[model samples]
Target: MYQRLITSRHFVPLLAGFGAMLCITALSSLGSAVQSSVWLMAPFGATMVILFGLPESPLAQPRNIIVGHLLTTAIGLSVATLVGVTPWTLGLAVGLAVSLMMLTNTTHPPAGANPLVVMLAGEHWDFLLMPVAAGAILIVVFGVLYHRVISGKQYPKRWF
Candidate 1:
């Protein structure tokens, strides 16, 4: 199963993009919410952009980033609101968000920690929309530009 999954064309792009983004995230010191949020760093956005944005992947496109992060944030905030922040509760929140993201078909694995981060930090719910979702969108946009410049890969096949 692992081999089969990794052999897909999407795999290489995902890995490459992730590596590039990780490098950028580490070297650059951007103060954006996305940068501030540990959960929204390079590997996460890189994977989403490569896997979903490139070749116009339905799952990796900008919409997916926006929608997926939004959904995950909601799940996390909801869990946090319902139950105060505790180790067990935070774990449950993260697990539930992951399950929900999969069920909803917006499975952005890196986003799995969003709920726990928000819950533990006791941050406002709006943080998801800002640095998280917006950060993701920015990453996808950057990826699109980067791929086009470096490799001539068309992104978002069709802009909505």
Candidate 2:
């Protein structure tokens, strides 16, 4: 079963995605180092999967990536700040984030986790800047550059 899961066809895409994540994480590390701050977050791993493994997916598009993250982060921060990080509040925040993303047409599956991250960490507004906004933008920009220069796949099927 394990052998069947790993195939020759999966090698390059897997490698490419892995490499892209490495580059992205490394850049995040560099940003953290230079600024002496936390620039990495958990949700970005899922973002990388969508951006690199499913570049042609609608979720991988620039608009979805950026707006989805921004919206979800805003919701997460708002809920966390206003309601406090109770179990019920976290649930409500996640539900609201998902609903808002859908309503705004900025649905991104990875971003669904942002509410949990923010609430759990008790993060304030700056949480949106470093890991949410900066990380999402980096992933988009990296995916575009990596696919265009190295992988030769269209990074974004559409910008909007």
Candidate 3:
């Protein structure tokens, strides 16, 4: 997975998408839905653009980005709700999210933070569906438009 993820075809678009997302987020002042103050969510959006939108590498394919993030959000939110908001709960939420994502075969690394963000923020749990899940969907939509329609790249090679 690491070898495939780091290849030139994957890395170049990943970086470009990351930069693009950052610029859009900054300009729009959406204030980053991710819990970490750092621009960590950028990579999640970037990965979607590279894999789902441009899809030069197998790992970057749309299935990996969309299914991966959906699984991550579901597991993360479920764990957060079950465990409640505490230090250990937060840890468990993130851990469960990661583990579930990996198990589900949709492992988008950056989404590991979603559970933690929901737990720490003490959100109403609906946050997972909105802003977090919604944001990801928006990112995917933007990537499709930018990489496919505009840039002439094929996105969502196969919709499962």
The numbered model that scores best in TM-score is: 2
Q: Where is model 2 poorest over a 10-residue stretch in terms of lDDT?
A: 1-10
Q: Against the true structure, whose lDDT is highest?
A: 2
lDDT of 2 at 143: 81
lDDT of 1 by residue, 3-112 (tens): 56544687756656654655356434355434454434333544544443344576666666666677777777887788778888888888887788778777665577
Per-residue accuracy of model 2 over 8-40 as CA lDDT, tens digit each: 577757756775667667767767687766667
lDDT of each: 0.63, 0.80, 0.58
Compared with the true structure, what per-residue lDDT tens digits does model 3 show for residues 1-160?
Answer: 7445544586756656664655456424554544532322444654544454345554455556666666666666676667666778777777877787777776666666666655565656565555556556666666566655444556656544
Tell me the lDDT of model 1 at 32. 42
Q: Residue 49 CA error for candidate 1 (Å)?
A: 8.6
TM-score of 1: 0.64
At residue 70, give the lDDT of candidate 2.
86
Which pairs clash in the backbone of model 3?
51-60
Ranking by TM-score: 2, 1, 3
The per-prediction CA RMSD against the true structure, in angstroms, equals 6.7, 4.5, 7.2
Shift of residue 52 alpha carbon in model 1, Å: 9.9
